[model samples]
Target: METLHEIPALRARLADWRDNGLRIGLVPTMGNLHDGHLALVEAARARADRVVATVFVNPLQFGPHEDLDSYPRTLNDDARRLSRCGCHLLFAPSEAAMYPHGRDAHTVVEVPGLSAQLCGASRPGHFRGVTTVVAKLFNLVQPDLAVFGQKDYQQLMLIRRMAADLCMDIEILGLPTVREPDGLAMSSRNGYLTPAERARAPALFRTLQELAAWVAAGTPPAQAERDAAQALSVAGFEPDYLSVRRRADLAPAGPQDTALVVLAAAHLGRARLIDNLELDRIVAEAH
Candidate 1:
């Protein structure tokens, strides 16, 4: 329930908890928390003795044309949600506090091959910003474990890689994606969907499901991707990329692979939505 805006004060609080042998869990967010975010909080609660959620809307991660100016910031509602979910501390720092004036040198973590595909292809330097800010928060919070939603699957992978590569002691957790009843993945960007577009948004997930079916049927990766792309167009989505890759390395799935992932991104009106599904289980069911 306690909200601390100052970094030193928050660090001191974490220090106090650690000094008393309490396990700390960190859930870093950009505010406007929803059930999906709370899912992360719940996961953290189950593992750690104390949980800290940082609600800073990081500017570094946003692009020039992105919705940084208009991204939702509902601290009161977010606090209430976190409180209901049993969060211990909320670090809601200002932009200046996060990125101080005269901040020059920056540390960038990139997961070489994975960062270059999917969302990274469209948004250059996006992951760098994300990694930088996240690294900063990790240092600031210094928790025993940190949790991120698997909705941003690539992001979760990159953070996991970065943390391991850098030898950070914190345990990185990837929680499953939380979605709306209509099958649309929950995101702050979902707020921008018009009523008409909102109705069509589930088409993205449906297309993903269809793609999963194709993969399950032992279809070729190229054929499945083409079918998924065509289905997405037919569903009224401005398809960005419909890709199939190994769940681990994110390299394209080959003919011999039993497990694969269908990752898709498209523009539903002005809002861009991303969704993915696993092909292994669906393929198993098909056989």
Candidate 2:
């Protein structure tokens, strides 16, 4: 696949594709390619005539103490994987290319209420960075549709909200979270886990799954949330938040809510893993 490192070159190529009446799909990511990321590229390939995969490790989304410097970069390896997955173009820009004016003066985008809870509470300014970079990518790529992984469910929701709120005429699609055989959600950060930690990491997903079962069985949502957090602790994780919320707005689920999700985040050794399970069908089955 063709790789473009500069914005002008990438935009020119996209313009040419648009002129030729080809629908474009975008899959934005930080390198360190894995099966999950390739799945996103494949999803894009299915929906659009041409697919563009971006591999820039966004500094904006990372907090000061976070692993910005150490985050893996495997552009060459990632490009090979993307090409195999049927991606048409790869955009791997430098930090300066993304933030030409320097981060201090760069314009920021925020989604308000959605950005202030869960992961946001732990990483201040994180979503601001996410929204801003994603906005910039949306502008630069200008794809008709973009694909994001549901593993970052909150980010997906926020991006959809941002695109609509800002009047961007692009479809945002969230694919299902890819997982390992043992139930661990596939993540680039999963590499940070040691062998011992890796064995225990699957508990995070298992906890969420059990929590889903409890909620399905008519357990109180608040109690289920607390139980999930406690289960993570018992599994040797430092629980961050385990919540059940309405799938639409991510607000706490109410008695009348039909569609719901169980979301959790926890620290396992050096890696922080986040995962969620949609419980709408489970609740429906219970009824």
Candidate 1 residue-wise lDDT at 169: 98
lDDT of each: 0.87, 0.92
Worst 10 residues of 2 by lDDT: 278-287
lDDT of 2: 0.92
Tens-place lDDT per residue, model 1, 1-287, is 89999989998998899899999999999998888999999999999999999998877777789888888889999999999899999999987787776234555656687777889999887888888889888889888999999888888889998899888999999888899998899988898889988898998988888888877777877898898899889888889999888897788887667677889989887788988887684433435
CA error at residue 121 for candidate 2, angstroms: 1.0
Model 1, C-alpha of 17: deviation from truth (Å)? 0.1
- For model 2, what is the alpha-carbon lDDT of residue 193? 98
Encode model 2's per-residue lDDT on 168-204: one tens digit a residue: 9999999999999999999999999999999999999
